[model samples]
Target: MESADETNTKLNGKSPSPVRSTRPKRSVRLTVKPKCFRCDKCKCEFSDQTNLDYHVSIHATDKPFHCETCQLLFSKRASLKAHVRTHSAAASAAKKKVFKCDNCGSKFTTSSHLKRHTRTHTGEKPFVCDVCGSKFTQNSHLKSHARKHTTDKLFACKNCPSKFSRGSDLKAHVRSHVVEKTLKCDSCDAKFSKKSHLVRHKRKHSGERPFHCDQCAAAFPENYMLKRHMRRHSGEKLFHCDICGSKFLEKLYLKRHMYTHSTEKPFHCDTCGSNFSQKIYLKSHMLVHNGEKRYQCEMCDSKFLRRQHLTIHIRKHTGERPHQCTICLSKFLTSSNLKTHLRTHTGEKPYHCDTCGSNFSENSTLKDHMRTHTGEKPFWCSICGSSFIKNSNLKSHMRKHTGEKPFHCNICASDFSQSSSLKKHMQTHLNKYQPL
Candidate 1:
């Protein structure tokens, strides 16, 4: 079985193209926080004493609040109260339950939480956005949605001046600056911010995949990962784009697709000023400018910007072609390459030119075909300065420089750069062999 990481990585196959621009440079210096109280456990520093005390609690093995029956430790009394409720049903009933529903027997800790839950059974959308026709169960959700309509981003990051509409989003952004790896795995010394993250990371080593999909036999380490995989089987796309009315299984894909309708590329590379629709794409593009090929093949010294590319390149060394064409049984290194090869058997010409109704099997072929209509010869020979529509034509033209003949004639010691000239030369030998 393939790992959860491999499955998740393969799902995001669509790569965004970087927009090359030499615009005016803008320098945004990253905010550096002063290290005051440093923890002896992880050596992480905190800005305040209160924050330092909170950080120390994560590493603390002994807790003051302990259950008499289970002997399970909890730092907070409220957490102990919640944990005790899981074991004893009678103890849960004795607790101060503020929110009780009349429709259902469900009880909540707070009234706000119960109000949110009540909406599910009542089918009531009390909170509606004024800007959009979108309705929400809670007022908080409506307020979060309303931020998109207005330029009111109250939560600003101290690490950088980056602002977010939601406080939760701001907290997540702040984590990048303050939080390093707080929790460490016992199997491996690999660290994580949260204990839950450490638990997920340890799964990779222990091979403990507890979460199983009901639709398929696929298993994952995390429940959220299992949920993500189920979307493929269920065909349930919750996220919808307002602009195109197109639905996506994931919100990240929907955001990436939104770029197609817009002319703006907000995420720019500091090194090259190359713009990208997504921040992740910009980070990947920056590797090109920095010459940072971190993912290297073990067999060969060949390096790649992305781990996916490295994985594909490693297959070349192993001769392991996992992606196979269903029709022809031909195997390929990558799924994209397999998809292209499958088209040969399927006779699927999806790409079409608008100018001329000519269809092409590949998008690249259609792009090259457009050059004929526009008379655009982008590929130019460095030797002769002669231009051609295709790079292959320009490559053949380059042989005039050093007179490199790749194709040779058997009859005579004649060589040609162009394969057509070699074929025409072969005809002479064929004529000579023919009896009159």
Candidate 2:
């Protein structure tokens, strides 16, 4: 080239082209890299150190970010932002116009909720389970019903062999094992896992029966108790015992009935080395050792270890005999008393002695009959050092020293120490009014 500028001018302002190279072009390839950063606790892999650090903060107890609306703490700002949306949604829901059901007069926030509620009155089940063929009112209910057929139980209890399909059921089961019963009754030495249970227990001490029955004058502390009382009026026995084929109004009654068939006593008393089939029975038995009478009668100086015993004792003063015999029209304070009275009419001696082959209507009478064979005199007098097989015999013998006449005759107005003596005294009046 003579001169680069002079050659461009002569060629009409055009430069000469460069020569082509015959070198092979190097091929460049792009590949995805494996995640190197991992968490020590949960073994979660992260692509970068920044993402791994954010995930690691979740395992820490310290929560730096907090929601301004509910004061709920969160580990990250993103979690706080997600929680703030719930408050915003709730605020929006509060401002929404309510939709009312004409049939039941039930109010709902949305038209969709009212439509779902209307199915209850119409007995309409739109959603059907594909596996079990069970119909449900809603899709969510059908999804829940579908879980019963599924073998996949995602949530499992860490402490026990119990596995649940739902995380909520697993959480509830976990509470049975590791429960912090912080809610305690101030009236008695009773602790509860929930505040609602503690509140219900407090009603017993306060004598506050807020839930009343519409059919009868009976009142209860809880709504469930009121429902159970209503079943007595309806004569509905929903729960049935598998072993004895006995039916009960409530599941609690059936559970207690099952204990009669069971030889295993799970609850043990440390004081007397006594065992009970139920924990509640063991709890009531513990009061005998501790001499703790928590329940007291308002009308009299009578104090009882159990609330039901106090309730029965109060009936003595008020004369509120709710349980009545249909045959004799005789009234009783408790259902158990009415049941025992019915046995007299039916001649059903359920309790039998294995040693003597003798039968008794009451279990306590059978227990006393067993004492005759064992020669066990449990009741003893403190003054005279006299022992008796039956506690009633010991009580009657004690009257000889103190001289207390409890049983009285309505005809002669004469009092006797024992009921048998009063019955014999009443025979004298029958002889006086003889038609000979």
Candidate 3:
């Protein structure tokens, strides 16, 4: 046998020692040569050296890496690479329930979210707040909260000239600007913004209201939305008004009320000259202007600006009499509606016509009806000298008198009093009805 140093000389073509060796010797003296053995059938050595017994046909046939959970097996290197995922998934399922957070009491379907949340209680904020000396568990929470100070609003809306600090907030804000939501439900073809929004909007489509209020028995699609609604019954005014003793359940509502006290008409409708403090208020006001009622009564198919309005609209159809008129035994859906109804019985039309002796249900309604008598058209049509109750009504009513109908029909030359009416009339040709 050749010496260890002589064996190196043969492997490297250089002599380190005078002693001759054929095979190179290792200092550790490994018992195994880490090489494949020759098979008797073919008299060939295997190429793979990781497992010398891989050359054995019987041992190579059994894939020990088979996943019990996924029941996947592998024979080749490529197949084993694919099959290892099943073992990893099974291992992940095993490690899932083991490491959990004690703070938020959240269970992770994967250990990643639990790991991220654990950093909160450990005072390990991987995400640091640049604004104040605050730290958060999520980068998104830091991103959204940062908008309160800096106006680095980068998220621009595709529909409108609006920007938001956060991408999700921008997505949510864009929903209020447009009437259409392209993302439809799998169960029902209802459209909405986010998946959660789609889920909530689906309740409007299927009427599958699951969350019910304990205090007033009012139902909502989402539990969080229901929690916000429950504050109405609980009278838990969490959002306190800075100006007065008044408080609101919603922060947005309180913000809008602050505008009312300040008379700050921030948002304005481009189509109609109507102004509003809240974006939703502007959108709802456009309903009266365009005569576009997206929300329809579940019973009568009559439309309204809001779901609450539609809920009120359904009482007229269901006749599930809610409010009782204490004076005249008349049962109505709303207290204000009953109060308006009582005026007809009592002949106490507080809202009187200045030009005629006509009394009405509501003061605004009476004010509106007075215009018909007095011809005092405060809402003048630019196309014609027609005055009306609201500027939007005047615009709609002007189309009826002017014969200059801008909203033309694809099927016919039919004109309408309102743009909404023209759109609905055009739908007659396509036979396209509102989807639920």
- List where candidate 1 sits over 4 angstroms from the true fold: 1-225, 232-283, 297-301, 374-376, 380-384, 408-415, 429-436
Over the stretch 1-436, how does candidate 3's per-residue lDDT look in tens digits? 9998778888999756466788888778656544356654323465454433554432243454443332344446655676667557645664555555565444555677567646544645566677675555568757766777876666666667776666578657856875656678878666764344555566666887776654356877666787688555334444545444345678877877665443346898888565576888887677776666678665565777678888876776677778887787889888777867877777764444545666555655755565566575567767656666666687667657666666667667886656888877877776755564
Query: Which is the winner by lDDT between candidate 1 and candidate 3?
Result: 1
**Candidate 1 on 1-436: residue-level lDDT in tens?**
9887667667987444568888988999998778798876445678888889877775554567876444456776766898778657634543766677776555656787667666665657788888778876578768778888887676666568788776678767877786778788887778876555565677789998876664458888776687688666434455666654456778888988776544357997777555677887787787787767888888878989889989988888889999988887889998879877977987877666777788777666876787898898878777668999998888888888878999988778898988999999898889997999
Candidate 2 per-residue C-alpha lDDT over 320-417 given as tens digits, one digit per residue, 9 for 90 to 100: 99999999999999898999999899998866677777878877787778778889887889999999999899999999999999999998789999
What TM-score does each of the candidates earn? 0.41, 0.44, 0.28
lDDT of 3 at 217: 62
What range of 10 consecutive residues in model 3 has the weakest lDDT sum? 64-73
Q: Candidate 3: where are CA atoms >4 Å away?
A: 1-233, 238-247, 286-301, 304-306, 324-332, 335-378, 381-384, 388-436
Cα misplacement distance, residue 292 of candidate 2 (Å): 4.1
Clash totals in order = 0, 0, 1
Please give the TM-score that candidate 3 achieves against the real structure. 0.28
Clashes of 3: 1
Better of 2 and 3 by TM-score: 2
List the global CA lDDT of all models.
0.73, 0.77, 0.62
